[model samples]
Target: MFTIGLTDHLEGPPDRPSGEIFGEVADLVQLADRLGVRYAWFSEHHAHAHQGHLPTPLLLALHLAGQTQRIRLGTAIICLNLHHPLDVAEQVAVADVLTTGRMAVGFGSGSTPEESALFGSVVADDRERQTRFSEALRVIRSAWSGDWSGNVPHAFSVPPHRTLPVPAADLPGRCWVAVNSLGSARIAGDLGFNILFSHLRTPEQYRDYCAAYRAAGGEGLVAANRPVFVGPDDATAFARAEPALRTLWRRFRQEGKIPAETTEPANPEDLCGHPINFIVGGPETVARKLCELHEQSPFDVANVEVRWAGLSHERVCDSLRRLMEDVVPRIANAKSLTGRMPR
Candidate 1:
């Protein structure tokens, strides 16, 4: 079965007054849990005024752990290069316990140059960054296994100590790497970790990544992050999303972060330009498109980003509710639906 999850964005209303976004997010998580979504992933961005709303996803995930029962909570891509590996491992391990094993950690080499500078760190070149990221994963996995030995040094002078109250025997968490390029996916596969392909590439690009993962002898969950919105009517959905969508693309372009597209289309259909970038429409339409994409790549999970560009909390929540209550069930019932199936 394919898993369905929401990606939480803490930024609030773009042009209207709305209450706290994160507070609404907590409510959204509960709704998703009740509606039977499989997971909820939160992002990590620091010091980007417009985007760094959620700097502490772990803290937020802990709060979500209390509010949710069955849905898995995860970091979409935590900036592992900015913090000590042991510190991240400790926090994630505790979160896993709190979530009772329903946790997935997706690590990435930090993307934004501004975020890196604000964190007072140099963004390593791709090669160096990938190496550090891979090593950090090894360290984190070792820490979780409670097998601290070998090249790992023991602080004999400090005092003999284990990390802390481990979770119950049955509660074990899985880890994933958020990859943007084929090389990143291959590295993730080589490490035997799950892959979380960011929603910045085309379906063709992801197909190649998935093929490489299989070829590399990696077997685990593979998912992609895609923006999703399902409204009762197509016209209403597109009308509401178009302005904000344009603003979003413009902002990314201003920051020189637009994806591999040559030019931005004046129309909504051309918005993503890349096939796998975003999913926007009514439930059935979006479902059909998603299924078509799934037929090509066959992802095990789909992380839906329902909140983006300051959409109203109510609007975002309503869209999510519609997706969970309406679109999700249809997608679940349709056996032949392809692309990234929901879990």
Candidate 2:
């Protein structure tokens, strides 16, 4: 069946205590689960200045596994360079067991230079970072096997043994590697792993990315994610989303996180016009765009974000409700008419 997923920064303003923010995320997740969103993806960030909380997405996923019966738990990415692959494998295994095999994992090299510095990761250059990530992935997959080939390190020096609640033998097919470049996409394909690319890039980029993936033997899931907002109508959606969109853009620019060619867009219309990479519209409007996107890129899953720049939990839930109830079905129909429906 075709599937949809939701992702979040689990952001809190700098003023609030961290605990309250986490609590709010839990409650919001419960609401999303009830609304029938398929997957709950937590993003990773550490010591972000504006409070991009939830540094340990795995812990949050594990904590909610018991509470959420239907929603699968995921990490949009677990930065692999700094983490011990064995630890990552074991934790993911435990999460898989806890969620009854409901796990969709995404791995990445690293984020900003500061984040890499804090972790003491060897991000001297892109090649070095990719080397670290590639090795970590190898060790993680080895650690999940019955033989667990990563045992060489622990056996020689470290001394941890297999613990309780090992992962199921089979992981869900949706496991992914977060990719933004042609190289990452090519490697992800060669490794036979699925790839997750952001909507921040254009649909044309994704079309090229997917073609490269297929050429290199990638045969698993292909996911695309975007900052998305839906409302009762276009005017209301634009009004509610404008400030948040601008705020997010400004921060991205200041941090040098956005592409150099882009400027912070002040107009809501400009933000929604595909230049800024956000989907903001009424139900039908959003639906049409999603259809256009699937026709072009045909991502297996559209992992969307409803919470950004201090949107209220109720508002996020409402957006998800429309997404599930109205947008997704129309997208499917659009796919059929265009003869490019997702699997």
Candidate 3:
């Protein structure tokens, strides 16, 4: 069976206090730890009230590390282009130490032009952004390896400098690259970093990107992220999650994240079949959909998005519990016994 992990955006309504949102995230993570989930990741965003309010996911990870014992905690992604690689490297190193080597690092270029521009790193095109990302990653790797004294060849270069507090051993193996295109996938492969495929893409696209990564000699882990919600039954899950899905899709469409021509699904079954949608249903259905997803695009890890689009803390906790206690065990048992899904 594949590794099962949970992802949270830490998003809440504007009416609520940010403190309360953070508290709820902590509680959910603690509960997840108790439920024996393998990993938990938090997303990073800056000045986006409607999106995840968390500006520094690494900071949040440090906080969560103090509370949870078994579950690995990490940043879903840190916008590498927005900050100096030295600072980022130091922060990651300290967090790794504090978490006792249970910290994973995911890096990417900033998603939107607005957020990039806010940090004075304008995304004129993908090429420029990629250059910045590669350069920063090179430096971060160098620092973590304790060979920081060297001139890295890039527009952003460092000259024989060192960053304090080297990361825990084998940090590179724990590093991840958030892939949005074939180019990024190849880069991740070249750097020997894990590749995380976006939930926004279709299975075909995911397969294509994975092919590119493997072709580039990427020997690291492959992870797939998707929106997943579970409940006692299909109707209950659909009713609770559909509105949030609608709101999330509407916002994504407005922001041009998804193609305008793509139509939204009308029901739970349609969602499971849609090219760019999520998995939402009862335990059996959720388990089956997860198996289908693995068959469609094989991955070593499943990063399940359990909280988004202003889903309530209670709703998220119930879904997480069902996913961990009900859905995951069935998948595990089926895989162990027959090497295939039951349904």
Give the alpha-carbon lDDT of every model: 0.73, 0.75, 0.80
In model 2, which range of ten residues has the least summed lDDT? 149-158
Compute the lDDT for candidate 2.
0.75
> After superposition, which runs of candidate 1 have C-alpha atoms over 4 Å from their true positions?
12-19, 152-161, 167-173, 258-266, 338-343
Clashing pairs in 3: none
Greater-TM-score candidate between 1 and 3: 3
Summarize candidate 2's per-residue lDDT along 1-343 as a digit string, tens digits. Answer: 2467877777877777878777877887887788777788888888863357878988888888778878878897888765777788788887787678878788888676677788776566777666666667766666676464435533223354554455676663557888887767877887767788876688899988888888888887778888888988999988887877887776666666666678655566775545458898898998887777777777777888788775777787788888888887877666353432232
Better of 1 and 2 by lDDT: 2
Sort all candidates by TM-score, best to worst.
3, 2, 1
Clashes of each: 10, 0, 0
Clash pairs of candidate 2? none
Candidate 2 clash figure, as a count: 0
Worst 10 residues of 3 by lDDT: 334-343
Q: Provide the lDDT at 54 for model 3.
A: 88
Per-residue lDDT of candidate 3, residues 70-178 (tens digit): 8888877888877888889989998998778988888987656677778887675777777778778888888887776677756656777667677776888887899
TM-score for each predicted model, relative to the true structure: 0.87, 0.89, 0.92
